[model samples]
Target: MSLDFAKLPKAVASRLAKLGIRQPFDLVLHLPLRYEDETHLYTIADAPMGVPVMVEGTVEHADITFRPRRQLVARISDGSSELFVRLLHFYPNQQQQLAEGKRVRLLGEIRRGFFGEEMVHPKVRSVGSETPLAEALTPIYPTVNGLAQPPLRKLVNQALNHCVLDDTLPEVLRHDLGLMPFDAAVRLLHQPTPDTAQRALSERTHAAWLRLKFDELLAQQLSMRLAYRRRREQTAPSLRATGLLAQQLLASLPFGLTGAQTKVLAEIRHDLASTHPMQRLLQGDVGAGKTIVAALAALDAIEAGHQAALMAPTEILAEQHYKKLSQWLAPLGIEVVWLAGSLKPAAKAAAIARVESGEAWLAVGTHALFQESVSFARLGLAIVDEQHRFGVHQRLALRGKGGSPHQLMMSATPIPRTLAMSFYADLDVSVIDELPPGRTPIKTRLVNDARREEMVEQVRKVCSEGRQVYWVCPLIEESEALELQTAIDTHVALSESLPEYRVGLVHGRLKPAEKAEVMAAFARNEVQVLVATTVIEVGVDVPNATLMVIEHAERMGLAQLHQLRGRVGRGALESSCILLYSAPLGEVAKQRLKVIFETTDGFLIAREDLRIRGPGEFLGARQSGVPMLRFADLERDTVLLEQARDVAGTLLDHHPAVVEAHLDRWLSGREELLKA
Candidate 1:
């Protein structure tokens, strides 16, 4: 099962193929994201503090020593100055060769340690008798688990040497753009002279990213185009509103519908009356009253003698949506069936039967709604809550269940129009920008970790007032390696801190029933505070929960922090979100926290999130159907994306039948190459 190294170039032979590197083209496409120059080698005296430096010195002293508490320290130094390098090797006997008086070269950042200044566990190398100090720019390749730096660098070098770039773009385009030849660009990209490296990266690296971005945009356009085509081809079943059931449902509503809701309902009504399947997105921020809009749409379907189904990503969300819809539609005698995986088998089967027999006009559940045995009698409208949580394939799978049910996807994450068009190109979008009247804005504040004790006291005060609180920890458990707080530890600490207040815990690892029970207890005021992970990000609304405290808030993405903040501020009482972060936050984390503190505008926050973390993390690569582009940063490559989108649109417009006529020749070739 040995890999063939001969297929790759000398520069990348060892590392490329082993890392699943296939063709020369593939190596060329896999460009280096970062580079480190070794030319700036320095001595201990010349070394700058807190900066990565290459130090060339003969080892005057080297020894593996242990401290009283069993701390292993490896001391390495030159003739003039000795430096003690600490190693977490409990068993010092294993590394016996690193003994005293061994000459070695080390590369790492210098830092002030507990004892003094040190380079802890630096990358050590044995110095040869007459070896000159090596000086060059080292290319750093993206690596996966089980793969390290040296082998990857060598493999990429080999791949670049052997690869021949078959120029795909027209010569005229290349010349006009002043682009270098593809082969030369690839070579310069891997082992360029300092000047050529920058040019090569600007041309080759960015060009490769542009190519990939173009491919992604094309795939998205094609998928959306195909979806549009297929929908157009289908003979949709028209559902006419009789007005009787709809009127009864509207009459049962406690408050009048917002103007925006009324307008959106009209649009939905028009879609239902048409013979085309409605594929739309219902985007609104938290507490924007999107559920009422969904309920109204369901009523329209139910009155037409058809059924509607709502799918939530989590059981808690499913139950929440079901409760809301049931209360709204109950007066009209509309039957709402709750279907979730946690349901007892017999009960689930009974619910399935109810939907299948048309006894239930509305169904709400998680992914279980698409189960083989759970077919609706006449599924007319399909609503998906938190659409971003589900993948494109899953959404399509749900639609496949009932003659391509009219789709309405909802997201609390308010995406900008441009991003929405790019991300959800296949579906028409409808935004609910306005929140319902009387909805109170959640005041957000940024506090350093030093204020944690005071924050806990504040939470105690809030709990004493009979209001609920949410304390979210970043991670599930404490890592022996990573210095991050865990939800379980925080739960224990909080419980101990406030002995009188009952604290409930929920996380992804908990059983469905356990999670639901905890959530229910929190909702019913049985638990005055909830200590959980991001599992409570989407659903589990406790309106009376007036306080949200996020620990290590800087570690969370803007969109995620916004979602967690959304969990509170749902009730009539004034609410506040305390973003507590560990001090010395990095630049990006600082920017994210600053933006959160600046405004509560979800749309603005989403845009800032996109700029800070890129589109991949914003919509999440797995869910958005948009792969991460190495060269083409969405923020920096806006012009290129727009160009690519325009090119694809023009090509499709002028040659509408080209993809269909030559699917294997055009699209499939690129698709197969991309897969390779």
Candidate 2:
């Protein structure tokens, strides 16, 4: 039976919608935040202080008093002792409801008041013959405005009563895994005995919870596995590396490829040579030489009589890639085209024409490359940098520009192995786990904001030494709401503080041309100090720039802090990252700064970030179209994820019907998006 939300009261429907509850299953899935032992009641005399208790008593006196600040006061007795109930704010109707001789039930914590033991603002209701009470532990669910606990509890109970579920896991699998049946697990979770509820809520390790979490994870894994299977079934162009162009490009590079890069590139080359399209994730720490591997892949595609397109998250990064690729490939007579959203119509048309005619061997652009007007003669490879910035649909849209083009996604923010195994199960993974040789490890330190003058003087000292420096701020402009320093303000302040130094400013609000100009000045050594926002976190490359000062660094995420620090240490000179945080740091922020100060390993930072913020916020799931995990916590439930993956793979291979049913049940309409 479908529990139609439309049939509910208007206020109820709106409140439920606000809580993201629309379907019967959604209501059932909305588990209790906590459970209260309302089944047992205690008399006023016997009730312990400082503990929440439920009590039934007869009201002896109730009135509104004005002397002590307009409060409502009531006295109640349970035949043994009297208790005081005080409400700092109450309506006249509540006073009448608790009038003399009326029986009432209340739940609240008992505390020593001015007069005697009292329950301030206790939940109060009239006791009548028709009043129903829970015989077991009462569930307390999360609620929004206009939706109280009683009504929400009732609605959830209604949903549970009407819910009809069919077990999707095979009996043999359940027995072998020692798992409880699905229906039993659901019932146990929603309505458990007092003891079970206490254990489950307190520890969050009950067998019922384990059963439900595993099922949810299994659904996600099955969806991604199915997507992988379907993709493998499709045919793709085999782009083999003839070694002529790749060897030429490798020889031109002044430095040798790291062992990790070589190994990952070999994996990519093998995938490209296969008939199946490549859905690969190339992950590495910041400055781990992923771009070279990407370039090699592009060269392989170009040598195979096909064009390659590399799309970055931002125009600056795209331009960076375009410049680097051109410098590497122009010597070999390979033409590279640039496409961006900010390009003039004429320029864009010319670039598109080059791509269409196959005159452009490699196309480097932002999201503009995936536009409908931009087409290629033989687009065989598609490379997406910072893959987290784009959704799965955008990837598909770009792939549509070619006939199952080999896809290679690169992320500087190293994903934890567990996350890659479960969340990215659909894509084959190749990790460049090593940094290039001779790249100095960035020395990081936490500088308190009280030493702002000292830090400014230090920047000047670094600039006086002929090295460039970067001052990164979290905000672009000052906000009256937040007192955090802005990039513009910092630029102005530094310009005044160091009048002799050339300081340039760049932020996301600037026009593309303006940003490029400012960055160009910094690159050419014309600007000694460049103040910018986090826009430079990914793409800016300057060999002479060796110092970075991040103001209010505690306000930034660990992944972002790591990325910003990566901007430095790219050159031969030793680099230092100073995290200028305010005096009072939150515990999490303190830990984040400590992590950044301790290690330059991006993978460790990612794991710590995941542990601190959980998976959704770490990957930016809301913006990136990463499926929101409702039941499973990636940090705590990693074992469940692994077990679910194993079970999903086996079921898909052996019991496809059961796997499909399970996916349909848990994921419902989200199976397609979960493929990412």
Point to the candidate with the largest TM-score: 2
| Candidate No. with top lDDT | 2
Question: How far off is model 2, as Cα RMSD?
Answer: 2.1
In candidate 1, stretches whose alpha carbon ends up further than 4 angstroms from where it belongs are 1-28, 32-223, 242-244, 483-501, 656-676
Report the lDDT tens digits of candidate 2 across residue range 47-132: 98897798889999988888868898899999879888999988878888888999999899999988688999998878874566
lDDT of 1 at 39: 53
Q: How many residue pairs clash in each candidate?
A: 10, 0
TM-scores of the models, in the order given: 0.75, 0.95
Cα lDDT of model 1 by residue, 1-676, tens digit: 2234564456554445564455544555566766665655576777887866777565444544455444445555554455666666534442543556556667788888776667876766666656575444667777665567886666566556555445543457446545555565555556545444455454544553345545445555554556565676775568778767766767776677778778777777787787888887888887777888888788878878789999999887898888878887877788899999889999999999999999999999999998777888889888989887877666766777788678888888988655765656656777777877877889998998888899999999999999999999888988877688889998999999999989999988998889888998998999998999988898767889999999889999998999999998886799999999988989998899999999889899988988887767677655654433444555665665666556556546665654443233224343321110
lDDT of 1: 0.74
Question: In model 2, which runs have C-alpha deviations exceeding 4 angstroms?
Answer: 5-18, 66-68, 129-132
lDDT, residue 372, candidate 2:
88
Clashing pairs in 2: none
